[model samples]
Target: MAKQRKIIHVDMDAFFASVEQRDHPEYKGKPLIVGGQPNSRGVVAACSYEARKYGIHSAMPCSRAYRLCSHALFVPPRFDAYREVSNQIRDIFWRYATEVEPLSLDEAYLDVTYTEAFNGSATLIAQAIKREILQETRLTASAGVSYNKFLAKIASDMDKPNGLYVIRPEQGEAFVAALPVGKFHGIGPATETKMHNLGIHTGKNLREKSLTELTERFGKAGQYYYNIARAIDERPVRSQRIRKSLGKETTFAEDIHSIPELTAKLLDLAERVFESLSKQNLKARTITVKVKYADFQQVTRAHSTEHIIQLTDLKQIIPLLLEKTEAGIKPVRLVGLSMSGFDVPVLQTHQPQLDLALNDEF
Candidate 1:
């Protein structure tokens, strides 16, 4: 017989907005949005529980969400703070497993099959980890324990905010069949609508569709759906990889329409550029300026240096902004500055202990 598999997925509750509310008590219970301004092609990065009550959610255009929740408090994103918290959570996850795969800032999958705590019980290990996280972080996390990635991630969301759900090997398939198609991870609104027309609204319905027909309709993802419908996700958890980029962008307090005002904007952006580079201990030979125009046309310009980054590079490149602006420059709306080639000091691996702080609710 094949050995029982053990996996756990833990997701932080409403991560970005929750962090905002946690830091500022006054912001709690109020509709809070963290993203760009509503009118300027902005998108919702996160929303508090209160904002969600108005049907506002992440990735919805801020303009549309503004209409839905006018009372919402719109705040710019604090990605720096969010990244710090994500590191802390990542540290906690490594306590139980070497195989820790992060999906994003707020969620991850841990392969605990080799951990001492498993001892033939993935469910018990998941429960203990959830409690430990709450104790250490003063934040709640929902956990799902299953034999594979797909069912485990699905189970994590089944009960949210602060939940521990377990899908045993014997019970997994029945659970998948009863699930709604819309609830599957990769099934988005467009595909769900297509599946609905085919009278396949539930996992069981999709199961009845022949594998070939499902593939014809959904392409390669249909194969993924087929395995999921039967709770047969075979993907293994892996460790986090180094991040790709670390940069920042800005929108002027007011739009810059003229030739001269735009140059001054670059000066302000140059200051921000140097600041991020200094903090991250990076010397980027590449500095990119992202320009958004009044009509929303955009362009990018980059200046590379073989030498280490210095503020003097900005002085040299600021002169070239006008020429870069020519092609797409229709009354420049917003300007942003970014520096790449940052690397984290990867030698900082330590075996962290679980720092649990629990309120102990029965």
Candidate 2:
């Protein structure tokens, strides 16, 4: 039999806000928000725990956040400083485990199944990592230790701000059974509401449904839900995650009703996406354009070619693609461009042809 994996998920507490507060002493113990000005169209990127008291959170519009806490300090994100601190945290992870999968700048999963450190106790390894992070970066982190990534990730969130929680292999099922379905990591608000309507309110409730029933409702993701409901997740902690696609999008404070304005916005987005592609040294065979109308209806149009997409190609193609959408006819609130299908190289035999497809989702 294979040995059970020992995984630890570590998450920084209010990472961006904490970093801002640490650098600015006067900001400490105050409700601080990190993102755009409250008057801008931008949303909150992160907020201090103090600000969360007023129901402010990441991704809430800055205007709404301001309304929640009028006196809260709003500041822009310093990604350079955050990246420096993230590097420090990553360096610490590498010291103990060779298998570290970073989820973001502030969170990661470490597989310590084979490590001799702390006599191979995953709990002890987590404790040591938390201590080192606090000492080295002056930032507190929460850690969760379990036999699988799903439970480990969920366990880490059970406690907060310098917390350390562990879920032994035997306790996995019962722990999941008692937990709320909404608290499950992969189940977002929409899915949670759907599950609630289906009378699947907890892990036990979810477990009662047959695999076929779940698959019939949720499609491919149903298999994942079925497994996690029973405390069974077979996903390995992948050390290197591949980049599949690259894209950029922007939301406007005011809706755009002109094709020229929309085209200009898409060209700008295309430039930014191409710049990112250049930085990664990647070439794309597929280009997709996404538009969201003022009514919140979203649609995508895609064009795939055998040749690598170039700026000249996009300049000509973008305007044509916009004609397929209802952007100018209906006010457009957002526009985006993305490139994908990177695995294939350019073929010399076939001439580049525009393979347009409608009803694509981004």
Candidate 3:
């Protein structure tokens, strides 16, 4: 029999808020919000547990959050500080696993199937890492241990604000079967609604549907659902996954209908994308512009050039792309710019085949 893989998923609890609380002792035990000023047109990036009590959460409007808890302290993000702490946490991950996949600044997956630590116990490894994170950063983290990325990621969220959970291979199927489809790591609200419409509220209900039926409804993602329902995910814990694209978007407080206003916003976004490309020492041949109308209708237009794109080219191309959308005819609520088709060589890996699907939830 082949050796079973052991994977551990670690996620810092309320990372931004925790860091803020730890750095400023005065904010400890108080409701804190991170991301924009309460009066500004911004959303919550992260909030402390105390803030959650009032129903304040990430991505919520800062204005709504203020209404919920007027006394809550609001602070802007400090990315440099977060990056420095992330490096410290990753250094600890390397001590226990050779394959460490960082999902973000505050979360990662570690494969320790062959390590000698704790007699190859993934649970012990998780505990040790959490202990070390607390000791070094004075912050708490939650961990999940399982045989695959899907299960491990789900297990990590079973508890919150500093918790650990594990799922063994023998228990994987039953555990998944009993779970709500919405609780699955990769499943999002839209998929959950579709599943519910099909009378598939739980994993067992999902498992009852044929792969063909699922694929017919969800396209390629159906196959992914079928396998995870059976506790089968063959995606490997990749150590070096290269990013294929980079982009950023901004939402306006009020909708704009004039071409000049839209062009000005696009200019700012283009500059931001160009700065990122320069910092990464990368160039691209494709530029995509995304526009969202006041009615919440969104459209994306892409322009490709034989030669690599330059900052000046973006400034010129954006105005042309805006014509593809009803930006001037209908008020626009958001505008974004992105670049891909990099000049750098791409990385390739021979991945194990099990399910060819992904979670668009994030």
Candidate 4:
């Protein structure tokens, strides 16, 4: 028989807000929001647990969050500071297991199946890591221990604000069966509504459908849902995750109809995207622009070249790309810019092409 894998998913409690509270002790007990100003057209990046009590959450408009709690502290994100702390936390993960897959700056998955630490007790290792994090960084973390990545991730979220939950091998199916279908990790609001319409309210209800029935309904994702309903996820914890693309997007508080405003927004997004690309020392041959209409319709236009893309090239190309979209005809609510096609090395031999060609349709 194959050895069961021991996976642990660790997530920091209110990561960005907690870091702010730790750095600025006066903000400790108060409801804090980490994002843009209330008057700005920005969403909350992160909010403190205290803020959550007021119904404030990440991705909600800062203005809405302000209305929820006028007394809540609103502050911009300190990405540099957060990245530093995340590095510190990542160091702690490395001390326990070699197979660590970081889901984000605040959460990661660690496969400790073969780790001999603490007699290979995954729960003990989780406790030690949490204790060390508290001792070193004065921050609290939650951990979930299970035999697979999906269960481990769900277990981490079961208890919040410095909680540790475990799902044993024999108990996995029962635990999943009792869980609401909406609570499944991959099921979004739209998918949950679809499942509910089909009388699949919980894991048990989901497991009743055959593989063919699920596949016919959810396409490829149907198979995933069917397996997770039975607590079966065989995915490994991949440590080295290669980034495929870098992008930045903005959602306006009000829809914009002017072509000039849309072009300006696209330009700003391109600058931010290019800055991030430069920080990563990566180059791209393709640039994509996405526009979401006020009616919720979305479209994208892309351009590719034989040479590496530059900010100057983006400035010239964005206007032409925008003309292809219905932004001026339809009110645009969101605009995004992204750079991809980084598989080629920076020094790869390619004939310099002058023509700007629209190649990709994504």
Per-model TM against the reference: 0.69, 0.91, 0.92, 0.88
Q: What is the C-alpha lDDT of each candidate?
A: 0.77, 0.88, 0.89, 0.89
Q: Which pairs of residues have clashing backbones in candidate 3?
A: none
Ranking by TM-score: 3, 2, 4, 1
> What value of lDDT does candidate 1 attain over all alpha carbons?
0.77
Per-residue error for 273 in candidate 3, Å, reads: 1.6
Off by over 4 Å in 1: 37-41, 118-120, 240-362
Question: How far in Å is the alpha carbon of 122 misplaced in model 4?
Answer: 0.4
Let me know the TM-score candidate 1 reaches against the reference structure.
Answer: 0.69
Question: How many clashing pairs does model 4 include?
Answer: 0
Best candidate according to TM-score: 3
Native-referenced Cα lDDT, model 2: 0.88
Global fold similarity of model 3 (TM-score): 0.92
Worst 10 residues of 3 by lDDT: 353-362
**2 versus 3: better TM-score goes to:** 3
TM-score of 2: 0.91
lDDT of 4 at 240: 70
Per residue, candidate 4 scores C-alpha lDDT tens digits across 43-136 of 8999999999999999887989999999999998999998999999999998988588898999999977766678778889899999999998
Number of clashes in every candidate structure?
Answer: 5, 0, 0, 0
